[model samples]
Target chain A: NAGVTQTPKFRILKIGQSMTLQCTQDMNHNYMYWYRQDPGMGLKLIYYSVGAGITDKGEVPNGYNVSRSTTEDFPLRLELAAPSQTSVYFCASSWGMNTEAFFGQGTRLTVV
Target chain B: GIQVEQSPPDLILQEGANSTLRCNFSDSVNNLQWFHQNPWGQLINLFYIPSGTKQNGRLSATTVATERYSLLYISSSQTTDSGVYFCAVEMAGSGGSNYKLTFGKGTLLTVNP
Candidate 1:
């Protein structure tokens, strides 16, 4: 099973450019989350979805947007990429509250 | 907002040595987890111990909810165990609406041969 899949394992974007990080899970998890990890730092939550069509903001949500249109997909969007946004992004999914979460390989984004 | 803190920002160990990493949270939580991020940047879930202790092979974890702390123990460490260990928690929210997972800075471990 492809627990969680993230597209564009690596990407370099120019300043002001916008892009979407794609994430999909085949586990049919109800909770999905988007996080970014900076150098030598732990992952920070960007956005989360409790279920299809339900989304909420998380810590460090600035410059990022997320949508949960289906049970298997949660995509993160950067409206205006900035150098500060350059980091490794991770997508995770869990069956529900208090359950083990599965993470994607991660998307390394570089904003120049 | 909840705050999570991990001890021993960095650790160097020889193969076969054992080590323990600690995580402390500022508030009560409903979920607690440990993850190992390898050099490749893959975050692998090591344990989900909100309370009590659980062992998996050479790795084990204990969470003391009453004390708002958790411990991750690695036995007979190998070079392959080199990575960043992160502790994440979900604070208990009113009405069961908030489930945002917060992470600590993490403890970097390097096991040498």
Candidate 2:
């Protein structure tokens, strides 16, 4: 089974452009999260969902929005793309919140 | 939010050498995990040790939950082991609603073969 899958492995967005980073999992996990990692820095949470229809803000959620419409998909939306938002985005999921989270290969987004 | 700290922000080692990585947390947690991020940027879960020790191949990990510290040991390092290692922890309760990961800056290891 594909644990965590993320699409658009790479992308470049112009200023003010908007796009969505797609993530899906077949693990039947209740917890899904979005994180971004920059060079020389650790990953920071952007948003998380405990389950379908339950979403919450995370450490860095200013330029992004998320929705959990189904158990398999948790997509992150970036509105008004800014260079500051450029980084490697990862999607993860776990059976529970306080457990090991399986991560996606990551999406490298460059905003110019 | 809990605070997690990892020691030796950067490390360089020769092939066949050994290394030790440490992680310290500020609060109590029933869950703590170690992950290795390869050059391809995929995070590989190493272990989920809340206490005692676990060994997998040349890699082993130890966690002293009572003391709020954990250790990871790498033996006979190789160039493929050159990557970032992270330690994360989460508090458990109320069906783990307190579940949010706090990650350390990570230890960047460069193993020269």
Candidate 3:
């Protein structure tokens, strides 16, 4: 099974350019999350959604936005990409609160 | 916000040596997991033990909920074990609020042949 999947293995965005990172899960997990990993920094929660039509801001959601329109999809949008936004983005999903999370291979995004 | 702390930010061990990695959380967590990110940047599942101990091949993990700490043991380490290990936990109180995960800065392990 494709636990969790993310699109665009690598991406380069010019300053002020906007893009969306696609994430999907076939596990039918009720919980999904978005996190970014910078060099030396483990992983910081960027945004999350508990279910469809429900979204929440995480520790570092200032530069990005997320939408949970369907149970299988969660996309992160960068309105105006900046150099500081360059990082590896990971998508994860869990069946429940105390369940194990499955992560995607991740998308390496670079803002130039 | 919960704080997860991992010890020995950096470690170097010989192929035949054994090592232990520690993770301490500030608050109660209903969900705890350990992941190994290899050199190619793939996060592999290791363990999901909130309490008790679980073993897989040469890797084992123990989590004590009462003490809010966890320990990961690597036996007869191999060169492939060289990478960053991360510990993450979900707060018990985060029920339905969101699916946020708190991650530790991770411990980098380098196993020499």
Candidate 4:
């Protein structure tokens, strides 16, 4: 099963450009999350959704936005991408609270 | 907000050697997990031990919720085990049900032949 899938395994964005990192899960999980990992640092939460239409900001939410329109899709949007926004983005999903989370392969983004 | 810290920021071991990685949280948590990120940047879940201990083959994990700490043990390490190990936790009372995971910097492990 394709637990969690992220599109555009790698991308290069110009300054001020906007792009959406697509994420979809086939496990029918209720909770979805977006996180980014910088060089030599742990993954930091960007946004999370408990369910469809319910989204919340996480620890590092600036320059990023997320929308959960359905149970399987949670896409992250990066507006006005800047050099500081360059990082590896990961999408994760869990069955519910306190459950094991599954992560995607990750999208390596480079903002120039 | 909850704080998670992982010990031994870096470790190197010869094949067949064993090692233990520790994770400490600042407060109580409802969920605790360990993940290994391969060099290719893929995060693989190793365990979901919120409490007690669980063993899976050569890898095992123990979580002491009351003490706000967790330990991940790897036995007979291999070169493929070289990666960044991360500890993540979801605070118990952060948002009633909208729990978000907070991660520690991570422990980099390198296994040599």
Interface RMSD of 3: 1.4
Residue B56 deviation, candidate 4, in Å?
Answer: 0.7
Model 4 chain A: ten consecutive residues of lowest lDDT: A93-102
Tens-digit per-residue lDDT, A1-112, candidate 3: 9889999999999999999999999999998999999999899989888899988888889989999999999999999999999999999999877799999999999999
- Please compute DockQ, using alpha carbons, for every candidate against the native two-chain complex: 0.74, 0.62, 0.76, 0.73
Count clashes in each candidate, considering only residues at least 3 apart in sequence or on different chains: 0, 0, 0, 0
Stretches of candidate 1 above 4 Å error?
B94-97
Query: Each model's interface RMSD (Å)?
Result: 1.7, 1.8, 1.4, 1.9
Local accuracy of candidate 2 as per-residue lDDT tens digits, A1-112 = 9889999999999999999999999999999999999988878899999999999888889989999999999999999999999999999999985677888999999999
Error of 2 at B34 (Å): 0.7
lDDT of 3 at A23: 98
Candidates in order have lDDT scores of 0.92, 0.91, 0.93, 0.93
Q: Which stretches of candidate 4 lie over 4 Å from their true place?
A: B94-98
Pairs that clash in candidate 3: none
In terms of lDDT, model 2 sits at 0.91
- How high is the TM-score of chain A in each model? 0.99, 0.98, 0.98, 0.99
In model 4, pairs of residues that clash are none
State the fnat of model 1: 0.81
lDDT of 2 by residue, B18-72 (tens): 9999999998888899999999888889999888999999999999999999999
Q: Tens digits of per-residue lDDT for model 4 on B31-86?
A: 99999999888999999999999999999999999999999999999999999999
